[model samples]
Target: MLIPYTVKPRPDTGLINSKLGIWLFLASEVMLFGALFSSYILLRVNSVDWPVGSTILSVPIAAFNTVVLISSSITVIMAWASLKMGNLSKGRMYILITFLLGLTFMCVKAYEYNTKFHHGLFPSESTFMAIYFTLTGLHGLHVLGGMIVFAYFWGPGAKMWKTEPEHFTNRIEIVGLYWHFVDLVWIFLFPVLYLL
Candidate 1:
């Protein structure tokens, strides 16, 4: 006698295990980021001389990236809405746009990091530079991860708009959650690190 397995796709449960698992994952991510931010606050209060961020960081560039990231959130929403309406092509188009925005985020981030290094804002500069690098680098890695997810979602091999539309919808929602978190963090970072 052998145990039987049910591998049938479960669309009835509303995107099956994807959304549930993604939410759990997102919750963990929130806690992880929360710790980082808390550490930033604690260390900031301890430092007598914080690195001057305004002279080092380019607010114009970062502000532009913020807009791009926020716009990607809109793109993901459009994709999800289109999928709900059974418009697979439109959904896929919006998903592709989201991926482009994610790519733009990475490109601009890489350029900014390079500029910081050129200005002698290395890890050894001060405690502030260390915090800056760690926070922004973590955020950049999240952007990279989003790009990876979007690459799979938008790829022809994924059959996103064809065979597994519900699965695609779940993927979009998870990506959207991650995108919104990224944008929210940047909102605080921009004013604190760039403006203040």
Candidate 2:
């Protein structure tokens, strides 16, 4: 038997199963990140000495990653739009671009972490470093997760398009929503962890 609301909207919610599921999932994610952010704020406010973020973190590198993430967000939307417009090849290309941008962001973050380690700056060294690592590291994992999904949809998952184009397009839209959220989180992180 076919799954209900896999393609068609549920009359009561006007959303497919996946769409509603993603939004709900994102709400939980917001709470998770919100708690971490709140903890960071409390820690910083109560601490006797707090270093200015820009003085410790590399603004240029963080700025570059911000651009990369924002660009990936655009590319993800373009991928969904391409599929919606019946352009499979273009959709695949955009998905590939989005994946590469995410990969670039991760690599840059890894390099930054390496540089910090080389200088003996670790999470244990200070509360600031601890929260910085916690925030960015978690966000990095989310980016990696999105990249994995993008890779799948760009490769084997593309077969779905041939058999169920609308369903595949809807899947792309769902992924785009998640990708946009991930990017939005980074936009908040860039200033909070790197400039504040």
lDDT of each: 0.79, 0.94
Q: lDDT score of model 2?
A: 0.94
- lDDT tens digits by residue: candidate 1, 4-58: 1112335666434555666788889889778988988898889897766777788
List ranges where model 1 is wrong by over 4 Å.
1-16
Lowest lDDT 10-residue stretch of candidate 2: 1-10
Model 2, range 1-196, lDDT digits (tens) per residue?
A: 7778979999999989999999999999999999999999999999999998999889999999999999999999999999989999999999999999999999999999999999999999999999999999999999999999999999999999989999999989999999999999999999898887
C-alpha TM-scores of all predictions: 0.86, 0.98
Tell me the deviation in Å of residue 161 in model 1. 3.4
